[model samples]
Target chain A: MEANSSPLHRGPLIAAGILLGAGLGGFVDGIVLHQILQWHNMLSGKLPPNNLIDAKVNMYWDGVFHAAVWVMTALGLRLLWAVGHRRDVPWSGRTFFGSLLIGWGLFNVIEGIIDHEILGLHHVYEYTIRHLPADLAFLGFGLLLLLAGWALVRAGRTDTTPAAASH
Target chain B: MLKLLATLALLLAATTAQACAVCRPRVEAAIHAPDYTDTLLLLLLPVALLVGGVLLLFFSPTLFSWKPTPPRSTVAP
Candidate 1:
């Protein structure tokens, strides 16, 4: 691929993919837990209840918070794919991996800050001793995504350069 | 094959194990009586967006990159 192939084509496609994937993936939380499993609300068992009216409002905002999570998952997948696809392009592995890690961190941090903290939608630890396994499973999934994304970006960097790469 | 086998084993183990009282009831309820109205709509919203995103990512072609499919004649030959 020529330098003229400039990685410019990546922007909107990647952005759109990330936003969509994150949104959809985040929706899985609400669907599987709240609606399906009926285990509890995503933010439930964590926050103290105010009143019946406030509880309903909290649930409503909880849905919105989950929507934001879905959006972030979209961004994660987009970064992974966009960076992985640029192996043949002139992009460096450092750039790709760095971008992906930063992107994932930013997603978590921003969601944590705005949606969870500021909005008072939920907390980081929303589980009892019995539900520890479930909480850990979700956390593990997140870590795996970040790791896999980083690996792809790192692999792309190495393969793109003739000096570091044999093939 | 190994991954599938491992997954199957895990599934088997999970099934055989005594269920957590609270967890079991919830899971069973979800399977037997899914409230589709409010939940289904919310679930589909994200899924629809994802499908659209994937299509744009892999299939959409630009002016230079576009591969035109053969146009069919209105009348059959």
Candidate 2:
């Protein structure tokens, strides 16, 4: 490559990774927390799932949530494809992975704030009368993700070139 | 693609419709009993914000900066 080669943009890859990461993270939430653990439903706070009918209703909303994340994942894949075709997009795993962490953490933070706290839609663990502890823990985890992701993303800046070519 | 999506849609519809033969209507009724619009908005809020933030970053990652993006190549000193 020439010395003055066009600068490889980091935005696209970051975006792609974030979307992909968040989408997959959302699936984990739906599958593990919502389904497997049965911690809480999409609207468990609003309508407690103490009975069969109510539980199914929550399940239905969970499906909808999954569908939205599915769309996000698809969009991320499309963005990745587009970035691959471009000669000016860096292919740094650090950048991408970092972005993914950011996405997941972002999901947790935003969802934690809006749904869990503000809307009172649900808590991390719904079995107890006091839901603050679990909810705070979830937010704490998200902050940790953000910090880790920031480090990786900063490190990725050193990786330049289309495919990490030697200077 | 169209056919696959159609089939999946049909399957999803079918499964949701028949989860419980006896109380399917009751479940559906209960779910839809509330103001449908409000429920949907609330449910979609998180995903929407998440998607929006990512898109903003994808378009402009400047919000989070590094030591400036390294050049694609450099002439070795």
Candidate 3:
């Protein structure tokens, strides 16, 4: 029998998964890029590196960008939890984790494209660009992420819809 | 848990130190300096709230409603 699902069960869980994936991934980008590698700053976060303008302007915007990402991450997780259904929430464990992977991949792709290519802000690695390989590789990583997210999303949808699966 | 806590503490320390030098200029134009993280952090709360509110409005009713249909009562003659 095809059981009906509610928004509480579907929407928030999915949204939260997506948001958490994005936020955590973004944070990792910040932590890794800024601290571990020392290629950027915490203020820079995931935004484009400051080379187009003076250092001061770059510093201001970089900090703003980092704060923005941090806020988004925190809120995103809360929203995910708040929006998910109590009874029908996807806790098959497998599906939840799979979605997380997909979501993380999706975040990487979207951020990579918008921040790196479209904005001409920065690359995945610093001081090693100006070549086709680096640019193409960056874009490729994003594409892969989107595809992975799409697959996981589809999987989650299918798992939830048992009746649909039968047909 | 300890690792996570320690990492978070480190991150907080780093963020604070990094932000101190640059957050003022972004908040005030008159300062003639760069400081955006502080204002950005200040703004983060409202934005996160708004996003959370939207998510709640969208999904709370469907996801959180725990009312169960009551069993029909049987009458004995």
Candidate 4:
């Protein structure tokens, strides 16, 4: 293909989408699970946070996790800005949105496996004695997200307009 | 090399150095615990996943060999 007519690079956009999605997904997990539901804190598994001091420690770790995700989100935004200016990146809503879903799904899968299963860090709903059910459900949700994201990305394959031209 | 060694020595001394009664146990546990590596890994898991996922997505074109299709006209014929 001619240089001008060459296909846009989807890497940056995909990177942006995944990072933003993971960051936002992490926020949801932190807010909903840690704060609202009180299902688990960052160090709940190790320290249990039954008392004020332990809870404070867990809260500190939670803040750290949130800070890390915030950095990830900011980096994603930076990548999005860079990709938007590039003539080789396609300005497809489908691609961007699809990648976002993929990123979120990837987050759930990776986090769920590492923290929930491998590390025994915490569960989605920790009230019950049998935490496996809740963990399985969380993984199931992740699988659904992955399927939906994959479908959207496949659909986005048809979109070919350069981002610069779209604007 | 001397600076690096000095820094390492300082770090080692800091961990063993006296602290308040309240903080001493926690600090000692963190340093001397048999499972310190496990604790560190657990702490790093989420950050690793976030970074790794982003990198994977960034290089997805090469991994998946994505090809650009021709743009479709929006206007109806």
The better-scoring model by TM-score among 1 and 2 is 2
Ranking by TM-score: 2, 4, 3, 1
- Candidates in descending lDDT order: 2, 4, 3, 1
Task: Tell me chain A's TM-score in each of the predictions.
Answer: 0.47, 0.93, 0.66, 0.93
What stretches of model 1 exceed 4 Å from their correct place?
A: A1-13, A38-55, A66-121, A124-137, A155-167, B1-77
Q: How much does candidate 3 score in TM-score? A: 0.54
* Tens-digit lDDT string for candidate 2 (A74-125): 9999888777776566678899899889888888898899999999988888
Per-residue lDDT of candidate 3, residues B4-64 (tens digit):
9999998887746456356555434522434444544432443354346446634555642
Q: How do the candidates rank by DockQ, highest first? A: 2, 4, 3, 1
Best by DockQ: 2
Each candidate's DockQ: 0.03, 0.30, 0.12, 0.21
Worst 10 residues of 4 chain A by lDDT: A1-10
lDDT of 3 by residue, A1-167 (tens): 11333321455555666566656766676677655675543223343344423344445544565676676677766655543434455443334555556555655555555555554455555555453465567557656765776666556654443212322
lDDT of 1 by residue, A10-76 (tens): 3333333345435554565567755676444534543333444334433654565576565556555
* Residue-level lDDT tens digits of model 4 in B1-77: 99999999999878453444566566455444686567657766777867876777566666433455433552336
lDDT of 2 by residue, B16-70 (tens): 5454888888988987875877988888998898778778876784644333333
Error of 1 at B68 (Å): 28
Model 4 lDDT at residue A130: 83
Model 4 spans with C-alpha error above 4 angstroms: A1-4, B1-41, B59-61, B64-77
